[model samples]
Target: MEAQRDRLVTLCRDAGIGQAELLADTLSLLLEGARVSVQSVGTEGPSARLSAC
Candidate 1:
């Protein structure tokens, strides 16, 4: 998880995002939530809105 976060931060920074850390954290949480949603409610649930986020 730490490695993934670090990589996300690095990618965000490379893209010149001002709040790289925050964005990385938000993306991590969003992805985790989507994964859990998919498992609990199937692919047609809230996880399907991920592309809209």
Candidate 2:
């Protein structure tokens, strides 16, 4: 799985997606997923949510 994913990522780079664009999109998705996971934790205690991330 890791090898296939690496190949796919390499292909995306070769196909002209800039590193910054890739990072931005990846980070956006990750942050959204994190937000949902945090909210699912019953809104208890401190959270690692980063509004500006």
Candidate 3:
């Protein structure tokens, strides 16, 4: 998790994003939620629907 956070911070910095840590954390949670949603539901779930857009 620490390594993932560090990588996210680096990516955010490279992308010129402000509040790197906060944005990384927020996006990480969103990804995690999407992953769990996909797992619990399926390809027809919210995560898949979001990816389609």
lDDT, each prediction: 0.90, 0.58, 0.85
Candidate 2 per-residue lDDT over residues 1-53, each given as its tens digit: 34544665677677787784465457556655666766676444223545433
Model 1: lDDT to the true structure? 0.90
Off by over 4 Å in 3: 49-53
Better of 1 and 3 by TM-score: 1
Best by lDDT: 1
Q: lDDT rank, highest first?
A: 1, 3, 2
Q: How much is the lDDT of residue 46 in candidate 1?
A: 91
Q: Which candidate is the best by TM-score?
A: 1
How would the candidate models be sorted by TM-score, starting from the highest?
Answer: 1, 3, 2
> Which tens-of-lDDT digit does each residue in 1-53 have in candidate 1?
78988999999999999999999999898788887898899888998898566
- Give the lDDT of residue 3 in candidate 3: 85
Off by over 4 Å in 1: 46-53
Cα lDDT for residue 22, model 3? 92
TM-score of 1: 0.74
Query: What is the C-alpha lDDT profile of model 3 across 1-53, one tens digit per residue?
Result: 67887899899989999899998998888777887898889978889966876
